[model samples]
Target: MTDIADLPFAMYDAFTDVPYSGSQAAIVLNAGQLSTENRMRIARQIGVPATSFVDRIEGTTVSLQFFSTVMELPMCGHGTLCLITRLVDLDLLPCDSDDWHNATLDLPKGKATVKYRRNTNGRIEVMLDVATATFAPAALDMDRLATLLGITPDDYSSSLPAEVASADFIHLCLPLRDLDAMNRLQPDFAGLAAFCIENGLETVAAFSTDVIAVDRHLHVRDFCPAVGVSESAAAGTTNAALAAYLFRNNLVKPEGADLFEIRAEQGLKLGRPSQITSRIMVSDGDITRLQVGGIATRVIEGKLSLPSPDSGPLSQQ
Candidate 1:
């Protein structure tokens, strides 16, 4: 039997200063001995959209795995942010040292380097410098999207056009005319799931900039019924992709600004309002780097006791 005390884990809500506003992710700091089935079960038990397992590997590199409620993902934004925040909070990440400001994380997808910097407000933000965005022309059924979202094409006219894009994961982008159209959304989960399956997409990101609120320029809703994430608390990768979309269309002046910043608010209707702030640096019509960051609040900390290998009929709750 595995000792429960040694299997302790910590949970944090990323992207929010408040206790429960951001996306919740579980972190198993020492997951070296856990099996794949055990990890999936633990994630499902946690009931969050995603969870992260961190294992200290050779010489200052940690191996990380991100798992959704259903399965493992190649990469995830909030999970990465949550893990790095925990590391910093625990003093595991060297803060005072000059060379410690930046570190490379080995994820399932590839090696991603993150830099820690303090903003003007004295808030520490972790910038995960993502690779270039990948775009390809793909067809979408706008009517199906409207039907699933309970909106029409007329509601999105002012936003001008919709398409499919993938920064890390492929999502169908539907631009709405105003926040009112977005607020009116009540997606049919089953319908959306079927559509995603038929179209070979991951999620549908319906967004608009017409709705401006405190410290925010855009509002977005990410729906991923296919992966069992009906709605994300905050989606960092998609928001970064959105920044790329804006710059690609020349909608924003990216060069002269301190940083091209955009705030994405989500999970409001579900009573778990979360916020994600993303920035990008563009030079000579090319995005040099991308950073998505936010605060993380610790929520729960506990451990799991595994049954003995010889124990009969292991029980799960």
Candidate 2:
């Protein structure tokens, strides 16, 4: 059994420049002293979409783990970005040089590396070579899907089709025909939650390429009540899966070779607009890698008193 300790935690709004606009994640630093149960308890206590717990190994490399309100996740893009931004602000990640710095993150998926450099815009551009997204045929009942989305079958895009994709987590991709359909989408939380629990679905990302004028691939909205998020302004893993879907469907064709960058706009309907960029590396007609990059702003800085393992669940704290 490990002893109880008061940990330092910070809140960061990722995928948006302004705080409280993007997805918020709680980060507890130097959390190596906490056990798995303790970590989960702290995350639940935080009661956010996700919580990132980091144990600084040496220099910039560390063991980072993500926990949703329900369970510990394999990887979370927004969580990672929030932690990096917090670290950079705290001087844990040195800057001021033109050379790009690398940090090794030991995640459940694998050892993933994050590269960061102070861009010309004065923002710390952080990018992670996340899980390679893959697609699978979705055999979904149109009626059932429509019911889950709380919309009529005719509202869905007949051309884009529904498909399943995964990078860090599996996502059911629904391409809408226009922004109105995307904005008016309302998921039956109870029904979709039950379906997700039964089928192991992490999230449902709805997007439309018909909204934005130019320089953007799509306007996206995510519903993940299954994973405890009713609606997310910006999601890293979910957007990466969307990028892979676009490439697989040839919606975002390569310039000349098998490479493409997709810029996405999300959370506008929620009033917390976000800018998310994804890079796809393809080879032999297959997506080799997918990476999501964005900016994050720290909102709150303080320490949290974690509950002692002997005292019981943190809900009581």
TM-score of each: 0.90, 0.91
Local accuracy of candidate 2 as per-residue lDDT tens digits, 197-264: 67667788888887664778889988888887888888988888888788878888776687789888
TM-score of the candidate numbered 2?
0.91
**How many clashes show up per model?**
0, 0
Off by over 4 Å in 1: 1-5, 57-60, 97-100, 118-123, 255-259, 308-317
Pairs that collide in candidate 1 are none
Clashing pairs in 2: none
Per-residue error for 132 in candidate 1, Å, reads 3.2
Name the lDDT value of residue 97 in candidate 1: 37
Candidate 2 structure lDDT = 0.81
Candidate 2, residue 311: the lDDT equals 63
CA deviation > 4 Å runs, candidate 2:
1-5, 255-258, 307-317
lDDT of 1 by residue, 41-135 (tens): 77898788788878674544668788898889777788877777777767777565333277778986788777775555554566676655676
